[model samples]
Target: MNTKSLTLRWNKRHWVLLTSLLLVLCLVMPQWASAHAYVVKASPEENELLVTAPQRLTLEFNESLQTAFYNIKITDPDGNQADDGNVQIDPQRPHILETGLRSGLGDGTYTVSWKAVSADGHPISGAYVFHIGEPSGSPAGLKDLASGSGAAGGPLKWIVSFTDWIQYLGLSVMLGILAFLLLRIAPASLQREPMDVPGSYKLLWISYGAASFAALVSLPLNTLYESGVDLNQFSWALIGSALKLTSFGQIWMLQMLIALLIAVTLLSGYDLDRTIRVRIWSSYGTLLLVLGWLLTHAMTGHPAAAEQRVLAVTMNFVHLVAAAFWIGALTAMAVCLPLLTNRLPAKVRGEIYWVTLRRFMAWGMGAVAVLVATGIYGSLVILPAPVLTSLFTTAYGLVLIGKIALLVVMLVFAGYHTKRAKAATGERLSRSLKAELAAGAIILALAAILTHLSPGQPASAGPYQGTETTEDGSVITLQVSPNVTGENQFEVSIKRADGSVVKDLEQVTLSLTHLDMDMGIYEITIPKNETGIYKADDYISMPGNWSIKVHALTRSLDALDAEFSIKAAKP
Candidate 1:
């Protein structure tokens, strides 16, 4: 082929490669980005030891946290209030909050209850038991805390972390590549003859389009994990519920816009009517993409949102758009720099790449600045002073630190890429830029892992401790002892039809069924102590007839359950 034909051919090849990458990225990013929010660590670590009573408790989340209608409750061993006051967002940490524990908790078992809206606006709540002093009576058995006994398993946690990492890395790669294509190749392609704008447009749209599909798949996976459903028998309702959440809804809407943009861009390639409308739609679609990013994460408390939702939402939009532009521009530079060198005259291509690199560097730097400023402001709005130390000590705090570290690495790569692009010696420059891009991808993957880990449980009394046992292979035995007042404790021993002690059984679970209240049934595991015996310690807060159901699983996995009556009288 002649020199002119050869140049055109190379351009076509570049376009094809760019389009393929976009398509792959879109298909993969959402799965990585849409990880479920979790608590990785908390203040007053599980089974913690405090030399003295703490003035306040803090809970940290892995990602930015939402503060609307957050609730936390602390009750002493005897069911007396331990919470000093209402729960409030702390002023120092972006993803955590602190609340006062009611004073004078007189050394006893305490139950901390918590409920909060995650960054995505999902409400999550649970309870943990902690003691101010030495625990009384025998502790509950480990079998009771195992899987099938209602306790989360280690494997499940690993799955959550793995999926989270996948989504994070995927999103970074997808965004980075798209940015590279738009800022670098698109402009050049437009300037060339017989502009393949339609093809380039398809690449861009498909990248986002694939992202939506990936998100859809991820939602179902998340639902299954959360519900602990068998993969083969996963319920569609769970998937439907996941889609209804704000994050999924925003992404779905963005996908629609992407679809429309692709249609308009393709039609614009032809001598189409309503050209103005097409342009308007295209611009609106871009704006929606920005909005999608903003709204998707807005449920997480924004620095301004703690004070007012309107301003927070607005700032969040700006932040997301800026990020997209920065990442997209960097990706474009990486892909185009080499191709441009091969296509245009050496000096002309070099100058073009340098000028583009300089502008993007400035823009990316500005984006980073805004991200940091807003991030700090947001943290202060939610986290209080007392629990600040939890940020580093807890799981959630560590993840946040990891994310910050990754951002720093990205900045370093950006700096190096800019410097080398400006001072490249032909072939060596292209390879170096590619390596930098690869490094950015790795950073994103780490972010994905961070998202999957739970931030930390709400600062509470700590973990429940007590013992349970079943006797004579037919009788169930339980003993209750608490450190706090106003909390009800129940101890019940039930005799089954068979004379054998229930202790010979393989597993034991206890449930409290209440009447006239929606307290919901609670299931607890009973552990075996010295000689063939099963024992448990559980709380029942009010004086009432509580049907205690003892379910014993034999070694054969056969379950035998017995019910007994119990009453709690005010002390």
Candidate 2:
């Protein structure tokens, strides 16, 4: 065979080896990912509880849970559910679920059941029972706490957010480097005398091949972890299950495509076949890297709303391709720039670098435009006002803000470097570009941190207001109270439409519901000493919105029923 044919054969062999290695690596990483700490015990102890009623139920897990998804449920002997609205994670101790019990239960067995997904995406579920005597006659026809369900509160959300940031930053940097090489450095490397070292290109192909595998495997595993699936069960079967049910399918497919492209490129290079086949595969590999960005970032973005999901997917595809072209070019430049500066005539290398830089800048600008447009739309859709506030107020929010700040800093640095590189003479220009690369690394680190912070609920207020009324009469009244207080207290007075005091009502029963958790009935027994004014020493445990159901009963007959809501601002 001619030397040319021998080169082609060698490239083919190289491609096969890299592809196989990547495939194996993708299969093995999930085990390590799944081995993290999980929920091991609960105070109510998963379907087991004492006959004696306790004021609070405790949950103990093998690992400290992320505070995002903590909650619990209480079921009466009759199966009526009293949901305690919001279950908060105590700040002083991060693992504890802290909240207060509802009123009304009088002497009977009750069951407390719970299901939570941890910060790392593991689902923890169990039940326990306690007794509440004099059980307010099971509050006719109340909604069962079991009827309501939601994702668990904990750190998994922040983990997903942080991982996303890392994936994007890493992808951007890698692509930028590749783009630099293709547009600026590759031609320079080719023009020079070919190095005699055997399998030199193998190092690049292997590293990228490994990255492609990690990207593919990690994307799906991350998705599964977020969805509350058991990571320990990872296998071909599980992978197939996730592909069928999750948004991860698209990510997996993209990874596979990139892996294939990598294999083909390696093969072409090893075969010493610098024919159109090699160029085609290399270009395809680059294209796959670019497209991978959409599968990873764009679909989850803000602009993804009005446009159909398919359209979002398409736009993300374009966005990723553009980013890869930009970043990949940067990678290529970093590798070839030093060599070009050292070996070639200074004037000739400088001209080449300038032309390449201009090309990369155009592509980078396009990627930025896509990122901005899509990002804005995504924020509007996914981030609503209250969640955004959470992003800033909560731990997750602070990190995200920091990440954005760093990204802005990176862009500014890039602009400065671009200007300096254009005007500088000799080594000064090279130094400036190198400094810009270092700055990019810092930005990537910030991106990683941002991913760890919670996307949090956007900031909003006034979703609730306070009001009061007599259950039987046609009197409506608004009460003004202090904005902040440690003790939960509210003043109330009622009058008829004619401004006469509502003296006919004998008693008012207050049933408070926290979020969905029912805090039974608190009967406001009016003492003869207090006249028409009724008061109780009972106080709520925390500050927030509490739905009050007021029932007016006269003698044995049902007089009337009325509903009023109030917001308890933090004191």
Candidate 3:
């Protein structure tokens, strides 16, 4: 009954199983597993004044959306819901969602509030205001900063993040312990009688239980998140909607199933000297299941939403596998310090401890090599141009910095532990392991927090610029000086392919509008400077997406106009 003895065995059949699972993960990703969907186009566009109320409210997104738990509500100036309860996606055009508006909607300003689950299962919600009659003094939005389409907020965000940390900690520990037992410790002791490390095994079960709880709770939590329902408002409908409508819900559901399979496989194993490794194998099924489990983490992670899917997901999987082995093995070693027990003589135990530490570290160092390399590459990919600016200016960057710092400290502790292993006492080794694990726990916390954040932190301290070419080879360059959300100047330059400036423009007006919510447009007329530059001063009310429409006229009766969007970062 101990170590859940099922007495079966396995072998190199695992290699084939592992390869097949890799192919499945690499070749097949969820069709709609992409970025969070936001409003790309809106009927009666943001801040548009209508002489008469529209018959229906429609919104379009860059990504396809699901119908379950999706809503489109129009709130009148008095803040009353104005749209009919039925919101549905257009059958022909999967990206568009529409709902009928009640007749005779009163004037003033009406806000369209929307909520939807992206195919990947992430919840996104936002609101925009459009006036029914005359232009209201200003667009009615930007009041709730968190309302911008993105991750969960309030207690839910923290709850989900904390759960993510537990899930990671549990899985990594279990994986590391299994690798240590079957691959390292068991082989080394093959000449001796089959031995058991109860301390390590017990730790394994504890991790298993923790991971299971996280997997079980993940569904309900994701339901609440994607459905935008509070705990008190919990319902079966929320869970159903999440499972059927969002990729996130389904992805986690699959992971939970795999976890249950692992539990069953782990409980049964043969433990003779010849069959020790085979005990955990189960005809290669266990290895396949473990890898499939890790693959799910990558599938639902930020990498799944990346533009470079294969590279990002592959890099992420390798990083996850390496980290699981490294951190997990270290955790297992911390629990099973052979020198600390009286089962063996002090001199003999010391030598065993040294050997175990050295062997584990040799593999751990290789894991660390991949971890550090991928970690750096991922950081660069997530935080694009002006990387340093994004790192210091946003919450995501701040957390990443802390995680890296903790990792550095953990590495220092590991290096010192290795250096002193030959002459170390039991108590010293225990202290060193505890320190490293402590830092590791903090690192996981940061990593968990990061999952709930968007890595596209628009760089704040630069002249944001974009260039577009016209059919006739004319180029238009738009620039924003100090792209942070505050007072700033914008510049527009028109040039031909031959590098000559188009100085004959009669008039140029910039229509700046906030895309996340309704804001009064910044219609600025850029009078040319005596020095021959077109620029004007303006202010961005908040951090989000914005649109800049260029309206210009040529002195010779020709017209040149272009529209583009830019992201403004938080100040």
Candidate 4:
């Protein structure tokens, strides 16, 4: 065949192989789905007008939330705080968050603002308006500062994500070293001894130090993300308040304690003597500390918020352990093997190399088995059937897909290394292990993003909609999504009676009312986008029929009105 013909054939073959791999991945990655927490319903619904003051304000979510991190504040129209300033999760319902109101709420408008970290460790929040007896002047709205969602923007977002990535990478390295020592090296050699590989123990110590520092630095970055505070404005006071008020702070506090414990234990050096009982005790204690460290992650993340929480948390813990064994073994071998081989006599070096590789390969195979099983289980618990089918449709799913792809590549390198390990002595084995570690680092990055990204768009009941013609022969259309009872987006489009799209308008205001239920008017200023569509987002809080009136102003006043309804229903 000619050169060009051969090149074309090769390209076609490459595409065919790539397509087959992706197809197999899709078939195997069915359960790698996840979701974010959102408000399902709230009492004293948004814009509700009450004859008697409410004794308490209650907010409910679709999934269980961390109580330690939730916040609710009520401010009366006069700008005075009306809540008791204490938020608690109801003992009867884990998903419900309640705060007591002051003894009496006089007439006027009151704003309820709330923030909570979802089961998946993502933060979400919103504000709603309610009236006592009669409506007063418009109250200022509270901004929702949920992390990794609508709350964070631009460089701030990248900062938070980067910090988290560092923490995760540090954790994987630390755990990997300890697990390698305790399971593979210590048990495999003579008398279940701690491997006396030079510089290996010191590498383990350094990994702990780096992980602890990353965890400490992450605490404040986490606070900034949760509180939506500007980087220039960060202060110790804000960090303190975060610890006092939110669940993220509390979980981070536990993580700090674990980090400090690990640090202290490492500082108190163990004897090099393998036969000493003290060495065994030190190893066991370090293992326990690392296990506790893993808890801080499991409790603060999606598994902790699962309905079958014990199962969820346990499965995730196992997944982390298995991952540590695989990644840590690769890391330990890569960093320590070269130094070890350089120091040993030629004959002993070759023997130790083959032995270590064989032992780690056997353990790694078991770790991979556990990882596959636990990963599937955790994904099923986090995502539903429909979401599973749309695994490639979301950012979270795509990241997950990337991780799986990298994992496949890592496995290929590992299998190649395993086959050559028995016969290959020095450079070739080292190169293969290094490639495996490189693949693992990419997988870690993808996993970090997956932890932060929302699994999919929150499932909604669909948009509440309305349309009306103005007195000036213009038409206005309004629509709201997942309009069931919580936060909803309001979108409006305008057109002339002549059937042409209305391109420009000075300002547009939307007011919604439910007079049958005595809910007072809640108004919002909708910004007109370049597309000439007006849009705004707010919480509806209650379930019932609603009346929407839109006012457009240019050189003249053009008014249009429509009706939409929201109902209480199952998701």
Candidate 5:
């Protein structure tokens, strides 16, 4: 049993994997509409031409957004800051984001650029162009506005992805190795005379260092990424806002606190092989702390946004624990095996090795079972009805396919190890162990990327439509896209009963009032363009019955007010 044969080191090949992961992060991100928070509706819609400068700019996302880091701005044709620098969102209606514009500016084409974190903590950003009076601007000008706005893509995304990988690796190794030491190594060493203070503890200490450092850096990195602030803009003020204003900030705090406790628990004389009582306390204590830490991680991602949050979070936590207990423990065991070959004799070491392997296999199988069950449930959570067919079509699905292939390779290697358990000191056994660990590394890498990607969502429903026939034999119809409780696209089309477009109207207004409550009336003068269609982006604000009134003023000063009713849906 040569120790050198069992060793694995970071060489050029591994660095290539890191580079590949970063490339994956950059290349597959553009088409990510179902990701964290994407623009569902923008006032003065994409590529729209406005008759006049809008007083304010508004954006509506499919989900609630974090206000602390909300960055929405309008830049003029010359790349001037045209927005009033006030991003506003009601705590009760975060989906409807609004920001005021600087008053009365001559605009050619204006770029509306925005960056925001979703409720789930994923950062999202994009830019769109709309013109006032006419369309006049180069793509380069809009690109300049997008760049000057400090959106959080580029190198920052790669850094964030790398940090995520390190965090997952460190936590899994730290906990999984500690569990293996107490549950497997300690029992055997206790049976014999007290063994030498081994290098396994040293390995555990290194893992703790990685995990603690990752926990510390993750907070600020998250703040920067979410706030769309670059390195030059980094400050304690930004970090403070994240901590104070959002649920994500609170979860980050909890994760940091748990990391500290885990460090203290390790340094405060709690050794795995100390005694039966110490082992029991250390095992149970560490397990609880790790669960608390993982629970906070679960609280930050897709679960927080899920309808069945408690259940989704619980399943995510369970999935992580099982993965640590199995794949992570295997990685720990492989690394420790080399050190063991140097310390213990052939007969005694072989007995302990085989015993530990046999014992772990039983528990590991249970962990595997749990992993299978939760993996299925997680997929279900990611892709629900109407989009379940995307299981083989999405980027998330491609990552899933990669994970399944790697997992099958790992299980095959594990079975080989089981068959060779009695004579596991050979180079074949060492090769098998390395193969299994290599598979783990790739799977974990994919898993890190998978977490950042969108869990598939159902395709959005179409707009609500209605038509009214005026007494003068004219027809007016209105359509509202995905008419949920947030911002809605209200479109009006008018024509004669003979199907000729109406040209008699001087001005048209759509007045909306909540029928259930006297919340006041909202009258927006929907602008009509050359296409003969009128459009206005406005907030529905709440659920239930609503009144829609179309007031059209004739060129001769006559007015026609047609009333219609609609039911608005919840967000």
Candidate 6:
């Protein structure tokens, strides 16, 4: 082929390969890491047919829930709520959810709807049904009556995620300023006569102001985020509840304290006297506040909530401190270094610039080493064993991999800049450093999103199911497999009321209908086996609340029904 044709063909092949890889990821990742906390088991169980009403309902999950934000409502056949409407986490078991049920359940089916904010801060919810005494002959269709799990709505989630990004950016910038001031600017002034670096001071002030604003805004934003409170009705009560009740609120309080300390530290640094600068530098308060800020950030993240909390938090703290030092130096090089190069005498500029960069290089190397070490350790803590496999299979792992890739790019830039430090000065070096900052910020954003994702196994492919027995003489069990829209498998099993495998059934038919949305009945013939198992494979066009009914004809008529809340897979 000619050169142009060959190039075109290669491009087409690359596109195909990329497309295929993405398709594979779409199919495979959900099997490894789903972002939301998922139900592991529930009290009375989904579609459980109870002979008597229970005193309470409980749910167990694979991830922790925000106890203050979860809700459960149970509705009886008569449409009265059976639950007291108060949801609580078990004190002894953080993942086990419990709620009191109203007494006096009659002989009919009852439905439950629940919504809970996972510890990662995303809301998830669903509905299930269970009958007391007997299976209601007709569909109770209590879909509307079922109170939804109060998952944060879409707009609210977006707002929270955005605020988290902005807050992290502000904090990183502020920390960078602190590192630059303490390790670079102050030290440089001590080595020689103090120089006028207006740009560096201006950048410091900007970082301080931005960090303070972000910290203040974060307090209320986090309150709204955690409580899932709406803007129209936000009040002092909501703010008070967040501060007293949620972990995020407590962390926000600590952040506010850090912001105040940062202000003090900046003010203390204003005196350029070597003795005062050294004294302020030596002050334990400043060091403690900085470390405490890092510690609190760690405590408020996934690490604090992790199984190996001590290790996770320690690694997180080390990782953050090292990263801040590196990013701070780079930011200083970009925004503050120019001030020294541009304003200083020609002869002193060469000497001071070289000295400052050499010192920065030594410290930067140590920081990068620590950053890499702690990053690896932190990843191990967050991800399950067989980390290599999870890196490809899980969403958190994928994002982490993306971050590592970006970090590699940053390291390359840092290496290049370090080599050229003697030859390159002013805007050229600053441009390279700015590129590194951009990459670093993106990594932080990815980290924020990663915090909101569950680092666990994917949802099960098995069906959402229920079992019931006809009053006369037949037992029926129905299951909706893959529990998601598009090509679901329905499995039904028939047995005699006395608990024997059913045989010699003339015919078996299954019909499905949406509970809320008006989808007319869709029916299918389920082929039966001699062992009393009947199965049909079909595709559900959409996701929503669906009710499936099974009718069997033998010497007599038998019927069983169940409701399923099917979810759509993420695109």
TM-score of each: 0.49, 0.52, 0.72, 0.65, 0.67, 0.70
Ranking by lDDT: 3, 5, 4, 6, 1, 2
Badly placed stretches (over 4 Å) of model 2 are 1-170, 181-203, 206-210, 216-244, 249-254, 274-277, 289-307, 315-328, 347-351, 386-399, 429-571
Per-model CA lDDT versus the true structure: 0.48, 0.46, 0.69, 0.65, 0.66, 0.63
lDDT of 3 by residue, 383-424 (tens): 634668668766677888998898899889877876665344
Query: Stretches of candidate 5 above 4 Å error?
Result: 1-34, 49-53, 76-81, 105-108, 137-140, 143-152, 184-197, 246-248, 269-279, 337-345, 348-351, 383-393, 422-428, 455-571
Q: Please give the lDDT score at residue 360 for candidate 4.
A: 69
Between candidates 4 and 5, the one scoring higher on TM-score is 5
Q: Candidate 3 or 5, higher lDDT?
A: 3
Prediction-by-prediction clash tally: 75, 89, 4, 3, 0, 2
Using TM-score, rank the candidates from best to worst.
3, 6, 5, 4, 2, 1
Question: Candidate 2 overall Cα lDDT vs. reference?
Answer: 0.46
Q: Name the regions of candidate 4 deviating beyond 4 angstroms.
A: 1-36, 46-57, 63-95, 98-112, 118-122, 129-164, 178-193, 227-257, 260-277, 344-352, 422-427, 456-571
**Looking at model 3, how many pairs of residues clash?**
4
Please list the Cα RMSD from the true structure of every candidate, rounded to 1 decimal place.
17.1, 14.5, 9.0, 10.0, 12.8, 12.0
Q: Encode model 2's per-residue lDDT on 1-571: one tens digit a residue.
A: 6322443354357435544553444334221111112233345432232455555666554334444334676767676755556576666764565445565544565656565544333334433344454433323222222211222224554455455544555555445544444443334443432221222354355546545555655655555554444566545654565555444455556656765765665455346457655654565465455455435555533222222456545544554454444444454455544554455576576655554454445455555555444434433333324545544543435554664565575467557645644553344345545555555555545544433322331122323334455544555343324422122234344565577765556676666554322233333343322354544433332233356665555445545556676544322
Error of 6 at 502 (Å): 21
The TM-score obtained by model 2 is 0.52
Model 6 off-target regions past 4 Å? 1-38, 61-67, 92-95, 116-126, 134-153, 184-196, 271-279, 282-288, 347-355, 422-427, 457-571
lDDT of 5 by residue, 1-571 (tens): 3221221121224434544553454333222123355555667666567798989887777678777777787888887889999888866788878889998889587877777777777776666667898666433544333321112354566676677677667767766776666555334552332222255467666766776687778778877777777789999998899899877688878887887777666654345447756655655566578768766766766767665667667777888777766766776567765565446675576665665565555556556666666776676546533345556545566678789788888878877776565355544255677678778777777777776665442122346899888898888898987775556788888887799987667778987776543334656685545666888765554444579999877678877667888756433
Better of 3 and 4 by lDDT: 3
Q: Evaluate residue 348 in candidate 3 and report its C-alpha lDDT on the 0 to 100 scale.
A: 67
Give the CA lDDT, 0 to 100, for residue 219 in model 4.
Answer: 73
